[model samples]
Target: MTEPMFWMSVAGVVLAYAGYPAYLVLRRSLDPWPVVPRAWTPPVDVLLVVHNAGDALEAKVANLQRLDYPAQRLTVHVVCDGCTDATAAVARRLASGRVRATVFAERRGKSACIGDLLPTLTGDVVLFVDVRQTLAPHALRALTAALADPSVGAASGELVIRDPTGFAAGVDAYWRYEKAIRRLESATGSMVGATGALYAARRQLIGPVPPGLILDDMWIPLSVADAGYRIVAVDDAIAVDHAPPDPAAEERRKRRTLSGNYQLLHRLPRLALPGAHPLSLRLWGHKWSRLLVPWLLATALASSALLAAAGSRLYLTLFLLQAGAYALAILGRRSAWLAGRFPPARVAAAFLSLNASAALALGDYLRNPRAHLWQTTRYQESGR
Candidate 1:
């Protein structure tokens, strides 16, 4: 085959495989139909995991107090691990006795902290909430109602990024698109993973996470799914929080997330279990493939570069196009601040940010295969 033809063929194959799956996810996400059932109240335990979360504890506690569900039926458990700051002190000051505060001065990972608190949970359902975010008043009811369906082992709310400033608006838009796709996947059946900021599951469905698991969001949902129940997304249930103001801070967050994805892929190979639903497949396509995308991207790029240097104009053009597309995406997101608009450019930026972080994460994971303690980034103040 001619050099040009070979490069064209390779590009076609990659586009057909990777590009098609992404199209399907985007198409499904754009469908504007409701998937969640109407709200009904059920007893649930609200698990708030905190580390050095000073005043933010107060806002989270206040949000919990404002939940539309019966206050008596709801219990809030705050797990404070390795917190030297007044996080524990602030939580105690706000506790009405309905809130149980578990303070551990010794630093254990968040996953381990969660494992420790699991046995103390007495509610029929447990909802994990990040101290930095606030749950919608009706989020609990919606999540609980979804859990009422026996097939749903866990349910997560829609995440609304509340950064009104342009600093992280790009990040917010990216999440909006993601949430849309997640909803569509859920409607088709099951969510790939629950949002860590706000997700609820049956207490019995909870299992011990690998002590070093960095991505509780991925692990918890996968565990529930492996147990034969669906991991669901409830669109009506919403949690509002801001993205990290600094791009560097956001990148740091993504790095940790990527590392967790790698760890989970290794520890929970059961994601390939039989009788997997479409949502599970979507999860695999959208997330699992993405975990290895960096390697695939790198290989393709290198191969294209070599083939082009060997006088394959077609292959060189294809490789350059892909690279240019990513470059434009990044530029578009960064330029949004100047233009005051959310454009197609931002979408490209979001993609670039995600994949770039994935690549960095793979490098970091390779360097340190063992689980290590890492600090969570504090982006915005948690309004108590």
Candidate 2:
């Protein structure tokens, strides 16, 4: 029983991390669905969502104004979601013919805020963005061009992290791996999700996201897929962001993101079943499988330990390798120097940290699905 459990767990881990991506690569090679992006300019609404981003609003608005797309075609909407700081005032001060500013008096989660603003959006394509990341001048152009393809419902921009070190370096590596998967998925079919920092969707396909929901990026793209359109990856569309200053900040971000995955699963149960969602297999491989990886790792480790106790040489070797990897992860966490010097250690630590975040996010999802609704108000005040 233990042997079967050990092998099953190992297979699951491989299937989640390696096997799925390999399948995508082969699929893309066999039957590639290419997006035909051209120099097409449509009216675009740049939706800049913020929560207590007073200091950053002005610069962000300036960044939007500087985009390579025609100023006349691009209209910037800065929505401040129940900001307690001078974010509202800054947005108002920056308001111009091209830049529109709206503020919510009460704190609402990002998804609710975006959903409420959907009806008011004025553009052929709605570009969603966060305050912190700056778009490359051509990013908007690239996304809009992809939208020019009638079959493509949405276009996701690639996120580029600048000057990462420590665990952030590992995060950067992971992001690259993730983007590769998205590219392959786009080539074969619609990707399961979009990069939340920067993505564009056709207004016609855009629908209201559930209130108090997290992972609007995933929801919007998947919803578009449900409407029989593809979400294409625009590698040229680049959104630039900085790594979190510290591990704690990264952890918080990861926890919130992983919890959003759970929220997505709960809201869209059809995605998990065969013949329900068009991209069900892709979602299972890319999104759902990773959610179970943490437990799979534990099962593999525990079973390996039990087999090793029974004097099995193969299981003993496997157990020692797993234990060594985790020990290195601990060392990487305790010593930033080691992680910085050794790339594998950094990756190991980041992998462990992410799995831990997944476990914690499960708790968060179970404890209070709406815990994030007022989270912005509380945490922003606390300087998170």
Candidate with the greatest TM-score versus the true structure: 2
Worst 10 residues of 2 by lDDT: 375-384
Local distance difference test, per candidate? 0.73, 0.87
Q: Candidate 2 lDDT, tens digit per residue, 249-323?
A: 787788888898888778778889988988898889998899999999999999999999999999999999999
lDDT of 2 at 140: 92
Candidate maximizing lDDT:
2
The reply for model 1, stretches above 4 Å from the true place, is: 1-39, 164-167, 272-283, 326-344, 368-376
For model 2, state the Cα shift of residue 24 in Å.
0.8
Off by over 4 Å in 2: 374-384
RMSD of each: 3.9, 2.3
What would the TM-score be for candidate 1 when compared with the true structure? 0.85
